[model samples]
Target: MTEHVDVIVVGAGISGIGTGYHLQARCPDRTYMILEGRAAMGGTWDLFRYPGIRSDSDMHTLGFAFHPWTAAKSIADGPSIRAYVEETAREYGIDRKIRYGHHVKSAAWSTEDARWTVEATGPDGPVTLTCNFLSMCAGYYNYAKAYSPEFDGADSFAGRIVHPQFWPEDLDYSGKRVVVIGSGATAVTLVPTMAQTAAHVTMLQRSPTYIVARPGEDRVANWLRGKLPSKAAYGITRWKNVLMGMFFYRLARKKPAKVKERMIGMVRDHLGPDYDVATHFTPRYNPWDQRVCLVPDGDLFAAINAGNASIVTDTIARITPDGIRLDSGKDLPADVIVTATGLELQLMSGVAFSLDGQPIELAGRLQYKGMMFDGVPNLSSTFGYTNASWTLKADLTAIYMCRLLNTMTKRGLRQATPYNDDPTMKSESFLDFTSGYVQRAAASLPTQGERKPWKLNQNYALDVLALKFGSIDDAMRFSNPGRSKDGRSTDAGTLQTA
Candidate 1:
């Protein structure tokens, strides 16, 4: 016999924890379980153990709206963030609801029964579970593997090569010359942190990336905590950061050239006039097309100024036994090479899906309000904002899902799905950004319609009005076992489940 739950939440990460909290808080009568592939809590925080791993966004916004972040530092380290997530789980008894090492292999929805029969591989062997609703909080990328591009002659390198995603526990780079390949957030973070002890560190990139410096300790948040209550302080800081982030993002989109100049000029001010800003700091693409890297207190620049770190802008020709050979004919000498390459994009945790024996092709389906896919019933996903704090969107999504569940119960609906009625609407990429991970996963991602309810605007304020307060009836039809799959009203009374 298969165990059954009101809802099955995949993945026990930040998003999953938030989902569990909301379900318990808002819909206490419902039963749910979080299935985690890994054996631990704190999803990304536990997975990544690199030297300087930290939240790119401030904790004020990264933290759930229900929980107020009381830390002094706005930019927190990996361990601290991990503890925060764990604490939240323990506080809400969500820790008891998580089943570790349960990898969900597939989810099959039955229209006749109005349930999802999920298959998984647990430690004991194959496991079966069923749920009325499926919540996907497994994140957007592959957890089992990082995106490792082929570097010519990489096998010939003598020193230990490490990827930031899967850093070794005992690997040591202290007092050794290290070369970090790539210019993304991971690389920028690793450079300064490793530079603290490493003999010398170099950040080598094929092209430049926009980077900004901010104070690690937020004075405003600290001051507010001293005067106001913790929750009050957290709320104010969260909005402040949100508005500022939006202002900068809007400015970048409206005046790309001016924003580009301003961003480059900030680097010059930090690294002095003599540093090669154009070659190392100025990217070819416009700002906001790709995410801008953030460094707290200009630590990366301080490392460069201290002669502990340096930046190189060039592509790799190949890896030699001694070091990396750039296409520009420069050989970066290194005792160890750290590949800060990005993550592999994975949709639905590579889980197979079927509807009444028919395989579900998600790629061809249209995204419904960035969470639900068209034609897929009793399923919702948590996809956070790319430009703002991830929790900002996750919190709203969790709250909205609970509200939806309550509505379904009140209306006597067994199944709800988004149905696209506008045939003439244009199709766009699901995500609005131009990041490499997104571009690589374009073929696998769902399509977004050109208008509201089908499209996803990265703006949180608009999403608040639409997702939080907007009607769930439009573009979405609710149905019960008595009604047809298209949600046609019927007098047949068989069962009611939402």
Candidate 2:
């Protein structure tokens, strides 16, 4: 027998857990279940187990708003983050609502019935489930595979190669020379951590990225925790971090040159006056052009100063038997190589979606409010901010989703579809980021509108004002295929034909 529910939430990650909580809190009458493809609760945190795996964003804002981040350190490791997520799940009884090893294969929305029929491979094999609304918190990247570009002679490398995404538990790198490719967050993180034990570590990059060092522990938060109550301290710290982040991002955009100089100066201070700051630290683009890389407490620089780690900016020619050969006529000898390149951006976990057996081409659809798609009924996806803490927007998304669901209940509406009829409205690529992961999949991802409501706002303040209390009915057509509890029939509106 097929199971029926008011809502079906895919993925049990941070966003998914928050989604479930908001559903239960705001719409107590609604029944919802979280279908997680993995057996674990923490999605990215659980998947990445490499050395120095930690949050690039501070925990103050990265943490859920509803929960208090009590840890002393604002920058937390993978295991600590995983434990925190599990704590939230257990506290809210969200763990029990999750169905592990349930991979959603496809979903079909029926216009006549105003319901979604979902097909998935559950732990017990093929299972069918029906729901009035589908919440996609599955994230945008593929968890099973990470992006690793092929080198000319990668197959000939005798040394061990590992991607931080699938780091092996039994693997040993102690006293070994390590080479990490890609200068993004993963490489910066791995370099210092591996340098502590590894004989030497090299961060190989095609181009430079802006890197800044920050204290792992927030002295203000610690001071507040001692002076104020737990909740009050957390709230203050969260707001402080949020406001600071907003200011920094705005300043970077308004005066990229000044911000760039300041950031470079900070890096120079970390690496000292004699260090080759221009060679390894200076980036071609302005600060905040791509996501800034954060190094906790100057550990990466300290590692470099201690002569355990080094940075090489050059193109790769091919892989030699022992190590990597660079286009700069230099070869790096190594015992292990880490491809901290990037992640394969996957939309909806590669699940197919159709409306009445007709395939839904995401690229053709309009991204409404950065959450819902134009002409898609009773369905929403959780996409967070690119500039600030991911959960800051994610938490707001949950609250807004709950608001939408509750509105549907009150108005006796079985469906809420974003309808765009303006011919003059312009469409653009989904993300404004120049990051490799985003640029690589920019063409395949969904398109956002050029104006408000449709445009995906990266500013947390604007998003808070818009999504938290914005009109849910505006630009959205609500209807009831079946008779509502209040004896109302479906409303009228025709979807714009492509």
Task: Tell me how candidate 2 scores on lDDT.
Answer: 0.89
Clashing pairs in 1: none
**Candidate 1 weakest lDDT stretch, 10 residues:** 489-498
lDDT of 2 by residue, 1-498 (tens): 889999999998889998888988888999999999998989888888999999999998999888899999999999999999999999999999999999999999987788999999988899999999999999889998899999888889998989999998887999999999999999999999999999999999999999989999999999999999989999999999999999999999999999999999999988889988898889999888799999999999999999999999999999999999999889999889999999999988988999877999887478988888987888888888888888888888888888988887787667788888788888888788888888888878889988877888888888888889888867877776664467664444432222
Scored by lDDT, model 1 comes in at: 0.89
Stretch of 10 with least lDDT, candidate 2: 489-498
The local lDDT score (0 to 100) that residue 363 gets in candidate 1 is 89
**TM-score of every candidate:** 0.96, 0.97
lDDT of 1 by residue, 162-241 (tens): 99898999989999999999899999899999999999999998888899999998899999999998899999998999
Instruction: Please give the lDDT score at residue 275 for candidate 2.
Output: 85
